[model samples]
Target: MQKIIFYVVVLLCLVVTKIQAQETFEQRAKVIAENIENITREEKKILKDKVDVINTQLENKSITREEADKMKIEAATFHAKRIEERVAFEESRLNTLIKEKVDGKIQEASADSVTSKRVSIIEVRYRKGNGNGKRKEVIEKRTTSQLVLAGGVNNLVTGGAVANSKFRYWGSHFYEFGLTFNTRIMKNNNLLHAKYGMSLVYNNLRAVDNQYFVKNNDQTELVTSSTWLSESRLRNIQLIFPAHLEFDFTPKKVNEKGETRFRTHRSGRIGIGGYIGANLQTRQFLEYQRDGFEVEEKQKSNFNTNGFVYGLSAYVGYRSTSLYLKYDLNPLFKNNSADQNNISLGLRFDLN
Candidate 1:
C-alpha cells in the first residue's frame, strides 16, 4: 500500500509539470501569432484590395481576360511572398522566446539553494531527444559585384632586338573592360575569395622611328620606311578570362539585429592572378604622305601573332581604385627572331 501511494504521487507531479510547460509554450505561440497578425494586418488588406480591383476591372471590361489573369498571378505572388515573410518572422520570434525562457529558468535555479536537487521547467520542455529543436531558415546575403575598367601604357620588353627595332614604350596604349562577379566563400567571413570574369582587352604598340613590322615565311622584323610616315601602330584585340585569388583586410561588422555583414568596400584590397586570352583579330594602322596628300591604310591579318596568350597579373587598391600591372610570359610573335613580351601598368576602376 505504501509503494502504491508513492508511485501515484510521483505520477501526479509529472503530469502537472508537463501541463505547466505546455501552457508556457502555448502562451509564447499566442504572442508570436499576435505579432505576426499585427505586421500583416495592413498588408493583407492591401492584397485583398488588389484582388477586388482586378475582379472589378475584368467585370467592367476595362481589362482583357489575359491581362486580368496576369494581374491575378502578380497579386497572388505578392500575397504569398508576404505570408512567407510573416511565417519566417514568427518562427524567429518563437525561437527567441524559447531561448529567453530557458535562460531565465537557469538563472532562477542557480539563485535557489536547492538548485542541485531541482529540475528546471525549460530543461524538461526542451530536453535532448525532444522534437522541439527547430531549424532556423538561413538568410541569403547579397554579393558584391562590379564593372572593372583599366587603362594604361603598353610596352614591349624584348630579350634582344635588332638595331632601330625597339618598341615605342611611352607612346603605346592599352585598355581593358570587364564584368566581375564576387561571391563570399564562407558565411560572415570575407577574408578570402575568388574573383573571376570575362574581359575585352585591347593592346596597341607603336613602333619607334617611323618603322613597321614585316612578316616573312617564318619570322617578323621591324623595317624603316622611306615615305614620310605620320603614324604606325600594331593593334591586338583579345577575349580574355581573368581570375584572381583576392584577400580583404577590413574588419567584419555585426548589424543591429545581430547578423554578421561584411563591409564590401574595396579599400585595403590586393590580388594576384593570371589571365588567358584568345586572339580575336590583329590589325596594323599606317598613315603617311603620298603625292602631297595624306594616305591612311589599315591592314588586318594574323601577322604571325600567337593564337593564344597568357600572363601574370596583380593589383593593389583602396576603395575600388587600384594600381594594376600585367606581364606576358610568352613571346608575342611566334617563330620570330626577336623575342618580345608585353607589359602594362595603369589605373584600374571597379564600379559597383
Candidate 2:
C-alpha cells in the first residue's frame, strides 16, 4: 500500500512539471512574436521618415523627381533588409527557447520575468526615442540667408538731378556683391521681413571731356588732360552695412498637415532701406598717349573724397531680379564748391 501511494504522488509531480515547462515555452514564443512585430513597425516608420525628407527636397526643387524616387527606393530596400534580418534573429531566439523546453532546460522563473519585461525594439534602436513613439516634422527656420549680386550704371547727381550730372551717363558703372540674411518679423505672418548684410561696393565714374580728377589744395576738380586721352575713370570702393524693411508678396504655402510656411524670393518683393559704411580706397585710372607711346597710369589716393558714406536704397521686382536704386545722402567730395552725390540704378539678384 505504501509503495502504491508513493508512485501516485510521483506521477502527479511529473505531470505538473510538464505543464509548467509547456507554459514557459508558450510565453517565450509570444514575447518573441511581439518583438518581431515591433521591429517591423519601427523600421517601417524610419523608412517613411526618410521618404518624407526626400519628397520635401523634390518639392523644394533641390533635387529632381527621379533622384527623389531613387532615394526612396534605396531607403525602402535598406529597411526591408533590416526587417528581414531582425525578424530572423527573433525567430532564431524562439527556436532556441523551443529546443531548450524539449530538452527540459528552460526555467519557469525566466519565462515569467520575460513576460513582465518584454524587450522594446524601438528603445534598443533609438535610445533617445521621444517617448510618444512618433517623430516631429522639421520646419523651416525663421531666418534664412542669401547671396546678393548687383551691377549697373553709376553716376553722380549734382543738385538732385541725374541730367545735370557732369559725369558721362553711360560710361559710369557700379558693381556690388554681398551676403544678406532675411528674418521673418511676425511670428505667423510672412509679408514683412528684416534684411541685413554686409557688402563691397565699387562705383566708377567717367568724365565727359578728356579729363581727370586732380586734388588742388583742399578741393578736388576734373581738369582736361594734357596728353591725348583715350580713357579717364575714377573708382571708389566702400565697405557697406545695409539694412532694409522688405515686403514680400510671395503667397504663403500650407503643407498637407496645414502648417504655414513662408517661401521668400518666390514672387514680387520690395525693399526700402539704407546703408552706412566707410570708403575703403579711391583710385584714378588713366589710359592715354604720352609722346609716341601708349601710357597706363593708376593713381591711388584719397582724392579729398568723403571718408564716411551713407546712402538710401530701394529695390522692386519679381523673383530674384529687381530694379535697384541707390542714392548717397552725403556729398561725394568734402569741401567742394559744387555738391555732388553718387547715385546708381541696377539689376539686383538675390540668389538663395
Question: Best-fitting candidate, measured by TM-score?
Answer: 2
Q: How would you encode candidate 2's per-residue C-alpha lDDT over 178-212 as one tens digit per residue?
A: 66788889877778999998776789999976889
TM-score of each: 0.59, 0.62
Per-residue CA lDDT of model 1 for 1-352, tens digit only, reads 1222222223222221111122343333334444544545555578779989999999999999999999977776776566546645655565455445435542321213322322222101111333567544443444555556677788887764322436676678787755565666666577776778767667888988888978887787788999867899998877678888878676676766665556554348888999997777788999998888899998878889888989999998865557899888788889987678888887675544
Query: Quick one: how many clashes does candidate 1 have?
Result: 1
Which candidate should be chosen as best, given lDDT against the real structure? 2
Candidate lDDT (C-alpha), each: 0.65, 0.73
Candidate 2 runs further than 4 Å off:
1-135
TM-score of 2: 0.62
Native-to-model Cα distance after best TM-score fit, residue 319 in candidate 2, in Å: 0.9
Every candidate's CA RMSD: 25.1, 32.5
